[model samples]
Target: MLIIATYDVCTTTAAGRKRLRRVAKVCESIGQRVQHSVFECTVTDMQFEELERKLLAEIDQTKDNLRFYRITEPVDLRVKQYGCFRAIDFNAPLIV
Candidate 1:
């Protein structure tokens, strides 16, 4: 499945800033960043669970906001793109 992860971590304090970086790192490990605070991840059920768990550990519930959007199959019908920032097609053949 395709997961869209978005986060907003308070950066008013040193610890909050650290949490922000940690959260970004967790998302970066499993997905492609489409925006400064948004990521597109293609992961299995188990992987999704683990990813959520790890993110939960890094964020301070009192200060940060995190969200996940599950994009179902037939993604082409669900997502529309514009401009120059093209998203990677996970199903495409690898060239490297």
Candidate 2:
């Protein structure tokens, strides 16, 4: 499967960049980075899980906080529409 992982640093500090570089190295070994914080990975289900585990561990080793979004598809219709609008679509419309 093809996976897209996007991560954002909470702050633009030296520690943050260091952490990002570590994570980027791990991703680079497994796949290619197509954007500043986004990686395009071709992995099997098991590989994907392992990658997630490694990323979490790497994040824990850093002082900076981080957020990530992982999706199996490149084109997520819902995200394409609502992500730009800062709108979310939950089963309950009120959640948005």
Candidate lDDT (C-alpha), each: 0.96, 0.64
TM-score on alpha carbons, each prediction: 0.96, 0.59
Clashing pairs for model 1 are none
Query: How well is each residue in 1-96 modelled by candidate 2, as lDDT tens digits?
Result: 666776765446777777778888888877766667777676778998888888887774345444445554433542353233332222235732
- Stretches off by above 4 angstroms in model 1 are none
Question: Which number leads on lDDT?
Answer: 1
Residue 52 displacement (Å), model 2:
0.2
Q: State how far residue 17 of model 1 sits from its true place (Å).
A: 0.7
Off by more than 4 A, model 2: 60-96
Q: Write out the backbone clash pairs for model 2.
A: none
The Cα RMSD in angstroms, rounded to one decimal, for candidate 2 relative to the true structure is 10.4
lDDT of 1 by residue, 6-81 (tens): 9999999999999999999999999999999999999999999999999999999998999999999899999998
Question: Candidate 2: global Cα-lDDT?
Answer: 0.64
lDDT of 2 at 48: 85
